[model samples]
Target: MCIPPEAQWKRATIPDRRSVPFFGQGRGLTDSQSLDSIPPPPSPKLRRAQKVAEQKAQRIQDFKQRCGPGFSSSSAWQARPWQHRIAIEQGIRKQDALPEEMEVVEDPTIEEPVGINPVQVEVGEFEEPTVDVEEIVAENPCQNYHCKHGKVCELDENNTPMCVCQDPSSCPASTAVFEKVCGTDNKTYDTSCHFFATKCTLEGTKKGHKLHLDYIGPCKFIPECLDTELSEFPLRMRDWLKNVLVTLYERDEDNNLLTEKQKLRVKKIHENEKRLEAGDHTVELLTRDFEKNYNMYIFPVHWQFGQLDQHPVDGYLSHTELAPLRAPLIPMEHCTTRFFETCDLDNDKYIALEEWGNCFGIKEKDIDKDLVI
Candidate 1:
């Protein structure tokens, strides 16, 4: 039979206890237990303290890594990237000192000892007592173009004025494209088939080869003279002038045969004329309808004055040849030449007019003595 509940409770009521191992406590133990022996369940304060300690330790490790093996001395610890760099740099400067390379220059004012041989004294002498006209002048020691000592006025290959070779390695004309050849050929066929056609034309017959090679270099401009600036007008201005000026010369039916490039020529003359009127001193031009032999300040730009019936001169031909000099002229569409012929006449050189007057219709008489073409 079980004892009654009240008697059982009374028997077990004696007050005795042993220690709790995790809490490190015997009966009524003090709170200063070894932390390693009995760790408390982590609290917010304990966790925060642990994190702070970890970060501090990490920072110390990083500092040690930066300092390397030589950082054993406490006084040499550098806490910043820049400060550490400076310390290393100082060490390097000390290690790499170049005392043997030192050059000692004497003060010119100091006089040599009286007993010293005159030859040795003269050999070392640099300062002259006074600049005498009779005394031989020292020859210039600078090399050509390498020394900034040359007079700055010098002409480049293109005759453009430039700085002399003070900085020999840096030439102002170095980046300039002294020569450039810009050109495009008519496709005639679609892009893909054109290549095959070009090949067939080139290889099948010498005549075809001569034809295809003609379209090279920039389209020649018709100006009365040697001014490259006026000959190559800005494209937009040329286009605007072409639209308006060619209208002055071409009839719709006649213009149908002229190339787009020919149309641009007519446009440039017109545009430049307006610029000239605006005091730009552009060259005045006369387009003669070689067919009618009608000389006028401006051509009937709409009417196509095509190629001459006979070669004006038997030599190399070019796009400029498409221009007519006499009446009953055929347009370029009608008067054709071989391809290679276009590249002839000093192929690399351009057709330069002797003077501006020969390029435009205006002769020396028409020009005022004070005016420039």
Candidate 2:
């Protein structure tokens, strides 16, 4: 019935929870000790190497699967295992060895390793290599060439780039027949491309130089332009030019067809209350309006000439340069050919600025080179 002192003392000293071990103790350890006991995570270099090895192994397995059992019997595949082993050993040595421990020696007596053949060399045994300039030029000679207008460069049998007539089919398709044109020979072409291509085909002949784009639309019975009509041409043309610039200014709110410089010059004509609007006008109306607003017509006429004289800018309008304006007008305006023919005062095949102004009735004293803009 009496409790022993030793048992009472033992009960009092004993704890209710389990005991945690001290550092470096058996069975139970501290957090730091536990972390230290665990193996350190692999180094970044080692992890990367392992990943690469795994990828290589996977690729090899995939190749084997695709090639089947017969693949292993092939010479390349048979030699692969040895190659892989050698590669792995070399990689390990590279990673583990110090820079000083690595040595490279030229062994002339040793047999050449697999997949490598040695080239024997002796002093002053070199020969100068011959180069074929023609072969080099043949590779892409067309890249250095530029063909004339309406023509194209083509490679011949000798791989030389030569100017040739462009295929008519290569020209863009016309959306409407209204885009068709008539040549001087009274033949109707599908588009300007057909006409130019035909001209290019006749390059060396006298007929080629004579051939010209006559008019817009198609061939029709064009009455001969009389001298009286030629005299009246400038009056109508000046009025038309002024009206064109004014109309362009009015519609140019959203469309930026006119440059800032062009718009500034056109603004004066746009605001002129007395200026005649575009329409079918009599020669009397054209001449009277031009006289009333002569200054307004001058700039637009000069501007048009400048725009057309772009290809060679030598103050002369070439046939190609005049095509845009002249071709379209010839069919509609009966006086077009005669007016232009008269503009070439010297019959030099080019329309000089002075001659152009004279054709438009600009006074000799008022004709200025600065107004070409």
Residues 207-322, model 2: lDDT tens digits: 98899888888799988998898888788788878877787888898757788888888888788899887788899888888888888888988888988998888899988899
- For model 2 the local lDDT of residue 22 reads 17
CA deviation > 4 Å runs, candidate 1: 1-349, 353-373
Score residue 290 of candidate 2 by CA lDDT.
80
Error of 2 at 29 (Å): 35
Best by TM-score: 2
Candidate 1 residue lDDT tens string, 116-234: 65543664467767755886876433324331222244656775555432332232222222121212343222222233334443444665444432222223432232235333232
Q: Kindly give the number of clashing pairs for every candidate.
A: 25, 0
Best by lDDT: 2
Residue 369 local lDDT, model 2: 81
